[model samples]
Target chain A: MLSLDHARTILDVVLKTGTEKGFKPLAAVVLDARGAMKAFAAQDGTSLKRGEIARGKADGALAMGLGSRAIAKMAAERPAFVAAATHAVGGSLVPVPGGVLILQGGEVVGAVGVSGDLSDNDEICAVAGIEAAGLKADTGA
Target chain B: MLSLDHARTILDVVLKTGTEKGFKPLAAVVLDARGAMKAFAAQDGTSLKRGEIARGKADGALAMGLGSRAIAKMAAERPAFVAAATHAVGGSLVPVPGGVLILQGGEVVGAVGVSGDLSDNDEICAVAGIEAAGLKADTGA
Candidate 1:
């Protein structure tokens, strides 16, 4: 189980890295394995809808059981399937980088998603945050 | 048709009432008649997902043309109907108290939803806020 404390820790590290790197105001979300929101926040200057975007990224990865990078690749190769999958998840799937599954002992525990900067930069922050929490980040890279 | 100012006023009053009454930390939202969010705030100590629940309450009311209190009653008396209705609304319809319609001159202008305590107490704060904004609160009771 991904505890709330772990989620909070991941969120804090992601936000801290974003601020330090001077990225656009970022939104981060942590979702437990059950796909329930564990923690989420958008920096004060973030755009209005970024929080939902962050959530979408995390949920998409979980729904497909792959990192968002993999989902993005799949979407590019199969747009129709990806579109249908998005609706199947209540439109909570954003096929983009920054959604990385959290792993412990090679088992999925949860996911962390970040949004605001370039997709690649967002993924970097997510990976860093997961590592900071002493967990492995499977970005499907 | 409520403006952002009206939404903010309703949100403020709801939080104030909840705090003064010693209820749990609350999340409140205001949605205009078009069902677009105008304002929202969640107290610091609110648990995860309360913000979404608050939004669901207001959105459910606006979608069904009835306050959430009435929706809860319907959900109990006709579980199958309520289940279908929930799917029709994209699963945002949380059949519970705390969603109240904002009425002015007998016209529904918007809605307020509060969550974070007992459902009954949540409803009270929502009602107090709508009335404080000089609009009538129709809880559909």
Candidate 2:
């Protein structure tokens, strides 16, 4: 189970890393293994849109049991399928680079999503957050 | 203007109220005036569905400028209209009873939604959360 404490820790790390890297203000979301939101936070300067985008990316990664980078690759190869999937999921999925699955003992424990920077930068922040939480991040497909 | 502090306070209140009432573990969502998620948390043992349902209810309330209870009534009266509205909003609307609009100084600041137990109980929790956050619950149509 992803504890609220862990979620907050992850959010803190994500935000701190983004700030240290001079990235844009960011929004981060942590979802438990069951795809339930454990915690969410958006920096003061971040746009409201970043919140939804971050959550969508995290939700997509959780639903597909893969990192958002992998999902993005799949989307690139199968635009039609990705479109259909977005429609099918009521527009919840966002195949992007910022969502990364959190692993513990070789099992998916949760996921973290970050937004408000370049896609790759957002992904790097998520990875940093997950690692800071003492969890493994599955950034690769 | 709903701040992150207010959103987290609201979520805490909702979860605490639900636990005190012996309700099932609840998931709660707080959305800013722009219909952006400000904070979200799902208590341990709650299903992931609760998270989505809570978010959907809050999103619906914000979009329609009405509480979820009012939306539910409207859905009952005009199912087709409600369906069309849901589709129009990309399926974010959930005409359910757990969503309540948050009012501050007679202005819509944000909204709160809870899910887990009976619909009425969920609504009650959301109201408690809003009130605990020193805001008014605008459940009236």
Candidate 3:
């Protein structure tokens, strides 16, 4: 179980990355081992819609134990999973760029997903967050 | 702009109160000065159902600049505004406990909304979070 400290560290790093990269990210969510929110922050100039999308992406990553980019790929390959998950979650699960899983020792311990920037930028921020914190990043197979 | 620091402070205080008072809270959300989510946390044992409810309350408070409790009251007294807002937000504007407007210097800066526990308890948590942060709680006119 990753501690709250880890989650905070990741978020701080991600926010800095966003600042340095000129990414106007909206919300970043850190989930603990239990897939529950430990910390969250939204940058100024981000739309409310962005926050919801970020949360949804984060939730999807945590639920699937993979980065959202990978999930997006899988969804492309297998539309059935996406449809089933969307229906199962009542329209909450979304495989998008803002989602990234945090792996520890080849096992996913938690996830940090972000939103507001472009999908690629969102993915970049999350990846940078994990790397900046010395945590393993699950780039997906 | 209310920082995530203040939002997290409110969340921490509310969670502490819930633990001390043995309240089974579902979830709590704190919005920033721009009515965006600054922080969100769900208790370990809170039901998932309460998450939506809590989020709805926060959204309503932020969108309307009033406590969700007051929103409910107004909806009863002025159904037209309630209907219009509800329709405008696409069924997202739910007025209930787990939401309160955050005020600083007699002006609304943000809002905190909670769901889970009883309706009264949910409202108490929002109020408690605001008071715990040394901020004023709007009781609605």
* Top TM-score hit: 2
Q: Tell me, by lDDT, which candidate is best.
A: 2
Candidate 3 residue-wise lDDT, B52-129, digit = tens: 577788778778887888888888899998989988986767776557888888788888878777777777777888
Better of 2 and 3 by lDDT: 2
The DockQ of each candidate is 0.09, 0.52, 0.35
- Residue B1 shift from truth in candidate 1, angstroms: 20
Model 1 chain A worst lDDT window (10 residues)? A39-48
Which CAPRI quality tier does the interface of model 1 achieve?
Answer: incorrect
> What is candidate 2's CAPRI-style docking category based on DockQ?
medium
- DockQ of candidate 1 is 0.09
**Per-residue lDDT for A28-126 in model 3, tens only?**
888766666766777766776677788788788877777788888889999997979878866767786768888788778888888887888888888
What RMSD value applies to candidate 3? 4.5
RMSD of each: 6.8, 3.5, 4.5
Sort order, TM-score high to low: 2, 3, 1
Instruction: List the candidate 2 regions with Cα displacement exceeding 4 Å.
Output: A19-22, A34-36, A59-96, B75-84
**Clash tally, candidates in order:** 0, 0, 4
lDDT of 2 by residue, B2-32 (tens): 9877887888889889889899988888988
lDDT of 1 by residue, B1-141 (tens): 576457657877898898899999888878777775555666656776887898889989999999999999999999999999889889888889989999988899888888899999999999998888888998979
Model 2's alpha-carbon lDDT is: 0.87
Runs in model 3 deviating more than 4 A are: A1-26, A31-39, A44-48, A59-65, A71-98, A102-110, A116-137, B75-85
Ranking by DockQ: 2, 3, 1
Q: What's the C-alpha lDDT at position A21 in model 2?
A: 95
